[model samples]
Target: MENISLVIMEKEKDTGFLSRELGSYEVKYDTEYVSSIYASREDENLYVNMYLTVPGEFEDWKYNAILDNYDTGLYKDKALLAEEDEDSYNPGWVIKFLFLENDNEMEEKINELLGIHVSELERVLSQLKNIEDEYRD
Candidate 1:
């Protein structure tokens, strides 16, 4: 079993458009990542965000490769074209909801957002944790 933490927040009923309106939501924060899952029935959309931690030592090629694999279409064109600067790279990504028709759909979307699988994410996170633990030794 992989080590992970999942907290399901409150169920927010009809509260208007999530993008334009502020609805009941929860934010999960940590040193490596900060995620927010918004469940707005009115808009029938669940917004997802997983801000990744980019190591300062990561080079331009490696960073661009990650973005290239993750972003779709013109969604990341600007970042792709941007010059390589240690101060300019944004490490976060946006994962729009696939289907928000029901609770099960939302769960599935959460598990498989960002064009990355849940198992892959867990494995990567576990490896990162192990590396950090070793650094402290």
Candidate 2:
């Protein structure tokens, strides 16, 4: 079992009885796919996996995770909705790991999952520093 919000967060996007997906980032009106957030770990390596819905279908983008199809990659922009919903993109985040001994492992997995090369997870790194700073004070 999980928290109410946690369970809903794990869903493609919580749906109302009318089948309307609603949340803080609900894809209402002219919107594309919903987003899924998850935390992962491997031995001492930890990471986050964000699954954004496919345009027009609200479907998982995993099928598009092919290097050859990089041009049509789902994670190319790393969760870009559609041209109309650009302003709604607020750089959402999830606390993925407490400790990751092999730093490069997460990057490698992200690269493989997104069908691209990623040197680092800059946003998370910056946020991690912020968290530590807060603790220091």
Candidate 3:
């Protein structure tokens, strides 16, 4: 497995009068492929949104397959499949993980989420590679 490194590209702290949001950060994964993360905190909860832009066009069946395979068991509750937008410029899937602000194992939970993200990303890339190999054959 490749070492996963995250770099914060942008950050913002909310100072609104009645807002519960603490801050938000845009993170980029230092990997061969393009991947990014957006994290925000609202009150006692933190939401981490991970996105991997597909190399080419997006396929509905591939999206469904990824959701079926990864979005289950322990990840079922914490990780959710974000809705797709037809009008959006970028075509990719997003998996959102929720964490409690005061949780004692917050770091561990975040690490777990990162692991899942990397695993799922590898799965997607493998499938694409297989398709390319088949075409070459």
Candidate 4:
């Protein structure tokens, strides 16, 4: 049996369903192709992967930011900098929950990753129910 199933949620396409509960960050040079949130179930554990990206020119920005928050400030004046070569774009993360025990654990994990309150997590979880099981992977 497959122990994990995940559904990709895009901020642009799923805004109507995800906007109020799921939050997104602003990144310079970002392409819409990056996933917003990935909600998954691993056996009995719940996981939410928050994905992020920067523009190709600022490809290393994500990694730098992860290592030091101060690096993210570069985006404030990024437009003034000379454009860097576009080799490839890489995704970033806020947190990754491997497994969760119950609704309470899910709520806590979601809150930590999304920076939302418990109530918002509750709402997101409820909305997830309407998605069909065909999304499983």
Ranking by lDDT: 3, 1, 4, 2
Clashes of 4: 3
1-137, model 4: which lDDT tens digit per residue?
A: 22222234422333435432332333222233233555454455444554433323332433333233312233233111212223324423233445443545554444433332222324433544343242332
**RMSD, every candidate, angstroms:** 10.3, 17.6, 7.0, 19.2
Candidate lDDT (C-alpha), each:
0.38, 0.30, 0.48, 0.36
Query: For this target, which candidate reaches the highest TM-score against the unseen true structure?
Result: 3
Q: What is the lDDT of residue 41 in candidate 4?
A: 46
TM-score of each: 0.36, 0.23, 0.42, 0.28
Report residue 86 deviation for candidate 4 (angstroms).
16
lDDT of 2 by residue, 22-67 (tens): 2222221222222444444445543343443333221122222211
Could you tell me which residue pairs clash in candidate 4? 29-55, 45-100, 46-100
Evaluate model 3: give its TM-score. Answer: 0.42
Sequence-dependent TM-score of model 1: 0.36
How does model 3 fare in lDDT?
0.48
Model 1 misplaced regions, further than 4 Å:
3-5, 8-35, 39-57, 71-90, 98-101, 114-137
What are the per-residue Cα lDDT tens digits for candidate 3 across 1-137?
A: 54454432222346423333433322233343335555655566556655644444546555444444443344566575553323333444555666445443444554565555567667755675445533344
Clashing pairs in 2: none
CA deviation > 4 Å runs, candidate 3: 1-46, 52-74, 80-91, 132-137
Candidate 3: residue 13 lDDT (0-100)? 42
